[model samples]
Target chain A: MASAPAQADLRTRLQNFIPKLVLAPSVAVIFLFVYGFIIFTLYLSFTDSRILPSYNLVGFENYSKLFRLSHWTTSITNLAIFASLYIGISTLIGLALATFLDQKIRGEGLLRPIYLYPMALSFIVTGTAWKWLLDPGIGLEHTMHLWGWESFQFGWIKNSDYAIYTVVLAAVWQSSGFVMAMFLAGLRGIDNEILKAAQMDGASNFQMYRRIILPQLRPAFLSAFVILSHLAVKSYDLVIALTGGGPGRATELPATFMYSYTFTRNQMGIGASSAVIMLMTIAAIMVPYLYAELREKK
Target chain B: MTLIKQLKLSAAVLALTATTAAAADVEVLHWWTSGGEAAALNVLKGDLESQNIGWMDMPVAGGGGEAAMTVLRARVTSGNAPTAVQMLGFDIQDWAKEGALANLNDVASEGGWDAVVPAALQRFSKYEDQWVAAPVNVHSVNWVWANKKLFDDNNISVPTTWEEFEAAMQTLQDAGVTPIAQGGQPWQEATLFDSVVMATGGPEFYQKALIDLDPEALGSDTMKQAFDRLGVIRENVDDNFSGRDWNLATAMVINGEAGMQIMGDWAKGEFVAAGQVPDEDFLCFRFPGTQDQVMFNADQFAMFDQGGTVSEEQAALASAIMSPSFQAAFNVVKGSVPARTDVPDTDFDACGKKGMADLAQAAEADMLFGSLAQGHGAPASIKNAYYDVVTAFFNGSFDSETATEELVTAIEIAQ
Candidate 1:
């Protein structure tokens, strides 16, 4: 017993030390690159940095200037529309597909992959394919006309008024499948007894889902909302590939705005400010979720 | 043990050889990844190779040169700047201001770049009387490319003024051919506006408003007129022009699907690629009323400081870029006129020859202004601000008055 205690003390300390040692490099990397660059960007937002980073602090000038620009305003407005629609539509489509699959439908395996296949493709590919499909000239309209459908029209991609919705379309198409997978897992994890009891109580199918199934899938819905919302906010590639933030900056998200200002527009200070704002937005969504997630685990 | 020793010795030898070989090679960061562009870059690469200098090709493709600039900034900031970078417009100036670019005065003076290169290009090539970049080719942005067959079929002559241009577009529209083949991207919209501004208010107004970011000029009636003309042009563009690449618009003109395209001379590359002959299959004209002025964007190779030492490779690269032979060889393949005035237009097509002549005429008159859309007229911030306004007006997001006001405000805020 004396030997066992002595040996266990060294082994326990070694075990603890080894894991931290193994994790040290990645932790330091995350701290230095992710958090460090974030802090650096925060500092740069207050400065007069342009084209390149300069440390001549100008207080709230960049922030003030950023707010005054209509482009920034447009980007913010687009993000609001894109985020709301992308999250709402994707969650709905995902839940619907998951619910349909959960009914033990025929060819569920084939249909499931087909649904998830779009998610497998990168946003760049989805954006590009959808861009071609949505274009009125060489895309769907043209194809339909060639096939003798003279009155076919799907030119939302070209309409500034509706271009953000097209971005919403492409983003939702890509993310919905993944959302479906999440919901499907949640649906599978539901207790069969709960559903049987609902059936025994003579509840309608819709009522059963509404009363029992839907409430249990809160975690999945939360995850999907969080994931889809962040993806919507940080969307750059899809918009870039599909809209390039145009038909007159109609699809200009905050991410694209930050990139354009920082690298292309040479307004690093404003770009940094926009980036800090985006970080704060993500943090606003992420922090409470993380806190709740960890608190529940504890 | 002996085999290990032998292997270690060979490894040492390989390392020594690699460093020595790399010393003579110039690392070039560029976005010339397209087929024709890469071929044109090969001309310079071969020229550099002929001079016994190696080339480290760093091609970052996307956003025109936006992605390349991002990579360049990261490289420069990390203090591992490439030996040279293909840059455009005020980008060279921005880099030079940061003191990351090396002084190319010695090679420039040796190559007689000051006398041979146009002053408009030299404006970007030099910083504080020091040559920091070497211009490769001049890409003029004010040209209107039209399908000659469509023009002939519609019985329309090449328009020389804004009203006549409108009449021609109307004829094309009535004839059921798409009038203007225009991409709907901000830069493309801004490119059309570049010529429209030059056409509407002439070069001096463009100089005052765009380059100088002058509030009075931006807010003036002339600016509104420019927007009004742009609005008319916008009306004529096909409905599906949004998010279309410049080349696709060019193809619309080439295939006779669209009557005309108001685009840069670079669109000619698409025409050439599509096997359409200029002056026969298509006609390249100055955007109406911009015949006297040239809105240009030049591609230049900017050498980095590299710890304040101008290596032989950097100097050779600069000198090679300025040489008349390389300029001619590169531009002919790249579908642009040579940057050098002295380069003969014998090898150029009809449009290329006209571009060279127009460039010379405009340069002589001090009318060679940088294209605002392509980041030559102003710094990126101001140019982008201008783009926001121009694009907004074109897309019906703003009226002429609102666009003008927004233009002035945006430029001021960018400043």
Candidate 2:
């Protein structure tokens, strides 16, 4: 009687808790492996360590060392220049492509994949292909010579002062298509009546785009900017594959410097300290922009 | 009756399994991806197989060995170190100090390594006088590789001195061909700078500046002359030389687009890969002025201590690495001289013979410099300081005077 009812209640509670029990292992795994390691890296930057991890407390020596090295300063400076140029150019180019595609043009569906194909390939493969294409004696220069233009030179990739720009160009080629897709989605989501009214008012093409469309695409720009900035801050594989931080360290970036310090030089403490500085620098740049975006959304 | 029969059968199976255990499986990680390097590795694979050892081959293809190092570090940190890793120079010491290496003194003693291997190589292969790694091959870094046909066509003989070499480069430049085929990466640049230092300053100055971290030597007039020569090299290179791979630079020489390349003996492997015979298609010479000085490093294997079931197997693998037969076979295919001095030179090619002869002479004269490649010969801070000054000079950011001042500053900071 009363015991039967209590037993039924116990069964209901067990049934209700099964989903949580099933999800516990995965949740705990993600937390421990992903988040735990990040915290550990953060903790290591505060200590002075060398070839192996050390627990000895030596506050800010590694950070000061990071500031002292010319390579570190150059790396941070180059990262900023690369990020700004890459993101700004990519967003503009992506917007233009999205707008052109929205005109009900021929081959729109077929051409979408053509532009996006570069994003599918790994950075290493991208770098190899671009290196050949940009090489002086091999690709473009050879092609020009064949066409009887013997004096033509497209050797920016070989110039120390201009090598980093080539990396930026390769990055833009790979990422602009991704930005275009996002912009295209936003363009498609716009209300049809607003555009119709704008046209009805006999508004000029440029004016209509500037006043109505660009303002509405603020969220898309923010999304693309954040993604590009994140990619730029962590840039390593492409630089390594393409230039290898040379023409005499002309194209060296923070990520590559950190890698060389940690593994190649066996200065784990200095490497971690550089990584911490990079994180702080990124935070300083992104936090205000992120906060404004969140507030605007609210 | 059935239960008794089953129990007897199980006992018999257990007894049979206990009599024989499976052969130990060893996984080796390396960065030898070129055709010639691949051929060289196969020789080692065959030798390992003959010893009843199973090899797990993990090859990462990049000449600079960057990608391979990254993957290795990740595996090691995660407690999954390979049985052996093909390492160069200072990297062995760096890894050993982290308590990851298996001490190989017993194996070294059994193989009589002390009698055959050079004392300079021992600095890198040993930590605290205990053999923590096995040296397989020695690679000399200051070799000048040239296209014999191109030189002959241009009516040029092999230059015997630095001044003559400069004149030859000028002649090649006048003929509208690139005089030097330089890959514009950092390590390649470093290689060129080191060769220049050897050519201009001789072995003693090189030892003082690179190995001893002597600030006074770095700021000397001899170092300034080296920088001036590098400036000449920079002017001679084709406009599109930046970011090129060393092998690709070798390809240019093979195709007759360039006349010469200053690189390590490993360039011989590249030449061989392209189906070019040593004395027929190309010639290997010591960079003219540095003919008496040999700057060398050894490729060695450091075994990591993997606990549990693989412990005994790891020790056996380490022992097998130091065996005389393995060393001879591995080095011959690698296009490098064996670490042991007593190995027969019968299997070596013309270039290998020349290398052996030069190595012998340099050793006898006490003109051999250990390395800046493997961190054992010089401290990392000092090496990087040199790299900074040398790289800046190569890029034309600093002139000879500025470079000399910077070199002094670099050494001061390093000390």
Candidate 3:
């Protein structure tokens, strides 16, 4: 240690400084754009900003007004329905497909990509394609009628009562394949010896899988739930492209509400309040999951 | 002249040409990307090109400039405002209030725009006694485009009152035809509401209920009747109308699948594009009781205040927009009447001629009013508030009385 002089110590310090120098710009950008804008939006929520951002504070007025709107209540109710269905359906389908693939089925590689194809597409494309397919006049219903099935009726997209489910259907179609890949990876990581041991103990396929295999996929389920909940809370483009928050604001989500009020409706204060609420929603879902993840690693 | 003097003159002329070529071109942000609309904009672009002014086009398309407005907000907030922007009524006023719009009084006076433009359009063009925007075209929302064959087959003359219109629709429905080709969008629903309010309550009551958002007017029996009329129209629309685009609804009328569409004059371009002649293949009439009244929405271009003053290019662009010749040429292709009331109608079609005449008469009689559905009668916040109530009423979420009550409450909250 004494042989190491000031020159060596200085060189070591310079080497350590290089990594921070490289990372500083990105860190600064994220802080300014992500956290700084979040703080700014939070600040604007308390102000009476309209059409453009103003700084005149009118604390909690926007929030109180937001809660009073039936439109906001409708959006929150829709979020509850969409998130539950999207997560539930996607997880079930993913697990089933992953289990099927784990059976060492034929053409696994070909079938895997085919199953995952929809995930590769952007949500906008999915929304648009689903919109056409679900339209009664010129899409599936039209084709069915042309096929001489005159009694065929599938107009869920047009029905305000079932429109949110259509959003869920498209979302599930796009994401279930990704979830399958997650489960497939998790299933493959399970030790082959454990399965063989269960079989030797005379455990049937259903019992072994139900008691052992399903319980082992906890992390996958947790991750999927966390990911889907946030995605549901922030869903904007799919609804806009598919339903445009209509046939009478039936499919309006919080993100669409925020964008509409801020830009189209010229109610920036209400928009900002809605946005802050959405961010807090995401944080509520993500923070506990992240904290558990880090604590587990420790 | 000596050789040296001739060379000096030639060099000076070359320098002048270079500077003119290097002059900043006007960058215009607009949402006019449809086929006919783009062609109409080409007329103005060519006009500017003729005067040695270059045009830098910035086109964004979606939701009738809603997406474009979002992009404009981002640009202006970032201090990269376009030289000019295509704006609607209160949007120009909103931007003017923000002090982001240029004062075009210099160009306004030079072109003598005050006398030619109608007062209703001028209401949007000028803010605080200063010209902030140039009126481009006027679109009236009270027109019904009906297939002539269907009307003739149904033995219905052009209905001139509410009872007659309802009777005709009932006849069409009995014949197993969809009576009204309506798109189930909030804005389209509100457009129908505009004509209905004007028809059911007359122009004066419409001014009070929609324009002024008076509590008494909004909650009156007249408002309830408007909702009931909207309910009648709703029953005539097909089940497949939900999430359908406006053009597709127009196509339904053109293809004989539906009887009529109550829409703005923009739908005329669709008929024209389909090679359907007016008063022949299709007939355009003012909604039954709205014959004497016009519900109008005008497109305008507001110049942004770059460097705290209007650039020469911006002034030239604004001047060209209001010129009688350009207005005529543009509106003729654009399926709208000229914003300037003095423009000649020789180039207009049969329907266009009717629109022009109706607009002039309505203006002269003080019966012309802005369309609330199209963001001219009120600001966006209030207009959107009306949209929620109107759509809910049309979709059976609210009865007429509840709709009237909701309308009052919604407007008050928005205010």
Candidate 4:
């Protein structure tokens, strides 16, 4: 009996060790490659590095310069606007799509791929395609003219003031479907009995969605929000492909600014400092929510 | 005893194999990804190959050379650098200061580079009196490329002054055509601004404002006049011009939607790609004002240091790049004048010949100035400030007076 119990304990220990062994390499790779390079970049930011990396420390000179640049300021401002609009609009539209699709709409199977396919393509290609489609003279306006609306003007992408919104629209188009999928999955997993009980109490359709369904979908909302926020904060390929931060830097974003400084201008120290500031800004926005989630999980 | 003999024999065989495989593969990085640019690069590649050298091309496609620089910087920082990189203006100096470039003094002297290349080019290509980069071709940024048929149909001749150009544009606009094909991108805006500045303010004021970063010059009445001229250009462009690509703008002129474009000689490549011949389908002229001056920026290949084990093949490749045959062959396809003044003009087009003649004249008169596009004239900060003010004026953000004021402010800040 003692030998049998000892053998069972050994077997349990071996099973537990197998999963850790399987996961260890990937976890180590993430730490060494992703986290390690981030720390290295952070260290470079504090130094007066230029064309090549140097260890001559300059404290916060680079950061002060970054703050002084109008491009940097404009980029950060654009980033804030982009993140809010993209997140708010995408979430609402995604929720609506998911909810509507949950009503057992005809052709739901075909429509799901239609919504999700934009996410399947890279943002660069999407931005290029959208840029052409939204171009005033060549695309929508031209199509409108072909239909005899000669005075049509759909040139938002060309307008300096409205260009960033066009970027937001394209981004939303690409990512809303992803959020829709998450919401759909969450909607499908909800208990039918709860909804039946709500209906039994004579709840209105809108009230049921507002009071019961939305509250229950909080986890999915949080998940979608975090994903969209990450995309917004680090958005570079879209801007590069669409506008190239043009019309006199009106549509410039933090990532493009960092890129221009680091590469074109060869101001690595300033570039690294900007990167650090971006990282800190992202963390500041996300840390509290992450902490709350982790605490709740515990 | 038998095992030891076998090991010795294998070691001898390995050494022989290594010696046979010692050809140095020279990796060259460039930003020429367009069809014409790719064709131009093939000439250089062929020249290098003929020298018994292996050429590894790393081409990144972007109009401004920004993307390629990003990749090059990463490679250099990671202790892995290409043997040569296509660089412009202060980029050479910036890299040279980091001790990232190899000293090409011997190569320059052997090629007789000093006599053939201009002194201004030497200023950018050398670091502390040591040759760091080899000049390939000179691109003039102030040429007015126009559709000859449009000009003929409108009964308009090439403009000789800023006022004449504006009137010509208005004439074209009235005839139901887009007058100026302007790319709304900042660099394109800056290019147009530079052309106007040279045309309106002349070389002296341009040098003071752009190269010297003189606040007074930036705020001068003449500079204001330049901005006003740019304002005219802005108004002449079509409403849907914003965010338009340079090639598309060229296409506008190609398809006869626009009458003219103020761009660098590289615009000729687009014309050539569209099957347009110089002086026949389209014509190239220096922007109005015979004394206006030509702003020149060269594309140079700066050799990076590869330590003591620098391969013989890379040395051969570098030598081949500076050869007269390569200069003539590459520049012919590149739609720019050869950097070497001694190269024969037979292979050049009519406009290219004119460019070469003007270059010689400018060289003699000392009218050639550094261009902002290539970053030769000023520090990056000051250049960007100039760009900011120019772009602001171009985008109708400010009037000419306000632009001049902003220009002075920007210059002062940059200093």
Candidate 5:
């Protein structure tokens, strides 16, 4: 017991190693399942695969074919429109709700759950509910006609130019709630003394938000953008359930395109290439953001 | 050590799977989850259950069966393939090429399938001169189901030619009726487009462009003319004909809201479920100018290989699928003709009789080509390419000429 310093250092070393050992299993799983499949997908992209994976390598043949496809180009254009509107509008609505709820208002507890309810439902559920509600013959349009408003119509889901926006509508509706919850947490976490101090410094309510509160909520905004963008990139079930990428490929996303090509279209190579490209796009956005966050914590 | 490891793994697998992975449970993957379709499937399920074979239903519901196909791929790649998969057309052949399908040679030989099943179906049933799938029922997509009351009330005679069909559509349109109930789903649009192509240029053209992938035929004026006719048909559709299900379109025709629907024989199941009589409630005719041709798609169950130890239950299931009585019973409910040419039409209704007659005549006349929209005539890539071009054309994104150009380019690239 008295042989103290060396023995104590050994104990500390064992404590550090125990935590790493506990983390090892999960780190190994992530490396194999997530990154390993990614690498497999990259390998499959270079081959002449069809309904099944074939190892007959044709190099960049699949990538070139993917580029030449009008459908692929259409899907990319749709993603651009979808991702922007999805992120921008979700952030705005989320921030607004959070800020409103941040007010010292009555029944804030009841209002918060109602706002956060949509996030509990899966995108598939959201897509199906919205599809029925948006269909012209069945939903609002039919109801309007029944109510003697014969000219009223909301058939944007069936229109190619507008169908992508409908997807954005559903995506934003489902996700804005979660973003609001995050912003709300951030708003609550702000030091109350800062607001008091701002008021004492002659800052108006607007000025208080502009100077003190908004800046403090930067982390929430960053998290919201990152989460929503990742969701946007990998959106498949919603597109499948809502429109099946139809009305002439109007709302086709890269995820749907990849599945269709790989499984149904017998263009597995091109599908794999599209999947790889999607992974790269996500990594490009996420890698820097993740690194910065970790570095800041350090 | 390796031997011991292998033996241990085998023992664990045997222990775990001993209860349910018994030889008789035929795990059949299919996409028939609709009411009438499920009812028809029940007939098969009951038949198998009676034969002491268990039926494991793996229903992945999407009309196109793409979701089920994805599931099948993942299962097969992971070495957990089902006993059988409900596949059709080139899809079966595609799976067969990957060496996943079982050779149903014993069942085919015992059942005399080659003698009873139609040659057109046999083209898909076999790969490398060995039976890989058992043909179940034949579905023709060249039928036009008309609202009998509406047509009769308007004095619209049964149209058997393009001119008459146009006159009928125009008459219905002029009378404030939606002429044709068409869905804007890509496959539905492609279905309409395929019918137009066949109606305009006949089966030979369909075979060349869709089946053979002849670039000349794809880009030719015949293809262009087909697109032109498609444009004319597009005009007859209602304003809200986009993104609707095929059954809903059939419902429109059923309720007299729409004059006619161009769909496969399976649409008859919808009419039947609605309690409509064949010729009394709805009349059937070939898509105009396609009277000589029957655009066909057949559903078959391709059994998975058990590494040369094919089970008796699998063989029995294949034989049962091809049996004349089961075929007749299944097809009667399924709204398709039996794949076996020998199955009598006594149980069939008027529309069914007409389908059988047209199928017979088309078979004799050598005009019974498989359907492109139904994944029969070509692989999915080429089929989807055709769908893209045709749908874009139908949606007014492309004219006849540009549609032709794009169609050629797409098929060439896909092929």
Candidate 6:
């Protein structure tokens, strides 16, 4: 302190402020673009806006209409179907693959990249490829028929009753690899000494995995569930590119329903309301998980 | 030597004039991105360029103009609307009511659009007694394209009545032929249903049920009968019809994999692109029960009131769209009859000529109604509700009576 000059001390003060200075602009951007728009959408949802947003407030008239639409109900039902199957199946498959890969198999490095490659492609690409493969007229069913298996049928993408499952399929295919990578990292983190100890205790492979390693992947499971449920709720591109929410609104998700109402059908208020509902749904899933995680960390 | 010098001088003079052309640059927003549609649009673009007016193409394709309309709405909301936007039916009227559309009375009056354009089309072209849009072409949705060989092989006449159409469909089915090649999209099903509605009842019923939104007419036995026929028509389609694109369905008919497709005149554009001749390679007929009537929806360009350097370009574009030569050239390639009655049929092929004739007959009989699939018969909200119920019914969630009731209920809620 005695050796420092006054100008040098001022320079030190300025240097100390740089990190906050650098972070301020992004903070402002996120505030305005994300939270501000959310508030704006919330305001718009209560108004009698159409094609374009108008400021004439109508006090939940839009919400009443939204609930009355059968299509909106259909979208909700489809989301429930998609989210449960998508999350459950993806978790099971990802965990199984992770466990299989954890067995010290040969060519592990090669197989790891192969399993994770689908995660690198965008949901749009995944959707389109799956659509082509599932379309009965040009895809596997047609090829099978040409090869003298004329009775083979795998046209689930075209059936209204089963169309959402195709969306679930595409979504799981896109995300399961990512989930597997998460579980793999978790599995690698477990102490090798504990496995040897469990082996010394006469624990079989399945018993060790069931009693110890699987229980240790708790955090991974929670993270996977949180990420997957949010993705399932916010899924728009996969539905749009795959079946376009159709075969007659069969595969429509909340995101697609929101876009159609807002942009296509000229019901801005209804669209905004649906978007807010979706946001609330995601919040409902995320808030509790995040709270528990943060409390545990503390 | 003098003639050569004169030619060079004229070429230099032309260059000078081109460089001296006006500073008005027009940005056009549309969804016409398909190959044939792009080529057809080039006629208007070329006409503009020849006049030294520049065209800025802003095209967004998909969802049957829904995406383009979305872009336009966002632009208008942000106060940066384009000079012109391609719109259909009630959309033009909707924009005009918003006071965002430019008044085109000057160009329309000078071009004598009143006498040339039909009265029904003029209903959408004008708003509050002022011309707001220029009609490009009339697209009638009640068309059925069939493989000519299949009809001949089955020894079937082009069906004119619903009963005969059912009989022909049954014959084709018995012969192991797919009776209809339909895409499993809501709008396509709604398009087919619109034709069905007109067939089951007359044009008057169509107006009351669709245009006027009369509850009684919508819930009446006539509407239920239309739904019943739709149920049967659903059975005649191929199992793989779900989620198919309209063009692929058209391809099925062209390749003789399917017998017929009930689609719009745009399907002819596909056949033409495939090198199939109309009435020789394929039979283009009015869908059964829709004879002597035409369900018309016009594609029009609405000029937005950009209010600065863009207004001149907007007027220029409007006048050029209404010009007789452009109408003839554009409609010949667009697979629809010209909006202008004065454009001759000499250049149109067999399908186009038949379209023109039917359009004229429809105009005379007062049978032209806007297409629901093209955003005309109702606003987007109400029309989408109808689509929901109709498509759900077509896919077997509802019986005919229940579908009719649901349609009426949807109208009430949306209205």
**Quick one: best lDDT, which candidate?**
3
Instruction: Please give, for residues B1-415, the per-residue lDDT of candidate 2 as tens digits.
Output: 9999999999998877643332366778898887778888887777767878777889987654656777888898887888888887777887877778887777778778888888878888888887888887888888889999889888989898888998999989988889999886666777778888878888788888877867788889998998999999988888777667788898899889999998888888888878889889999998888878888878788787655333555667666666667666766667788777887777788999888887888888888886563343565655666677777678766789988887786556444
- For candidate 5, write residues B1-415 as lDDT tens digits: 9999999999998877864565768889999987679989999999998988988899997777877988998898898888889997889988888888888887788888888877888999999999999988889998899999999999999998899999999999999999999977788888878788888877778888888989999899999998898899999998778777788899999999999999999999888988999889998888888877889999999999977656777888888898999999998888999898888899999888888888888788888898999999888888889889888888776889999999888888788
Question: In order, what lDDT does every prediction score?
Answer: 0.87, 0.80, 0.90, 0.83, 0.88, 0.88
Chain B TM-score against the true chain B, each candidate = 0.93, 0.89, 0.92, 0.91, 0.94, 0.92
Docking class of 1: medium
Which residue pairs in candidate 3 collide? Answer: none
- What lDDT tens digits, residue by residue, belong to model 3 across residues A134-183? 88878899999999999999988887788899999999999999899999
The interface RMSD values of the models, given in order, are 1.3, 2.7, 1.4, 2.6, 1.6, 1.4
Give model 5's docking category: medium
Worst 10 residues of 3 chain A by lDDT: A289-298
| lDDT (10s digit) by residue, model 5, range A206-235 | 999898999999889889988899899989
lDDT by residue (tens digit), candidate 6, A1-298:
6657877988888899897899999999999999999999999999988877899999988788878877788899999999999999999999999999999999999999998999999889999999999999899899999999989999899888998898998999988889999999999999999999999999998899899999999989988998899889989999988998878877788999999888888788999999999999888878988898769866
Tell me how far the alpha carbon of residue A56 in candidate 4 is from the true structure, in angstroms, after superposition. 2.9
Superposition error at B398 for model 3 (Å) = 3.6
In terms of docking quality, model 4 is acceptable
lDDT of 6 at B326: 93
Q: Which pairs of residues clash in candidate 4, taking residues 3 or more apart in a chain or in different chains? A: none
Ranking of candidates on DockQ, top first: 1, 6, 3, 5, 2, 4
Which residue pairs in model 5 clash with each other? Answer: none
lDDT of 2 by residue, A204-254 (tens): 899989999999999998999899999999989888877777667778899
Q: Please give the ranking of all candidate structures by lDDT, highest first, separated by commas.
A: 3, 5, 6, 1, 4, 2
Across A10-32, the per-residue lDDT of candidate 1 in tens digits comes to 99999999999999999999999
What is residue B38's positional error in candidate 5, in angstroms?
A: 2.9
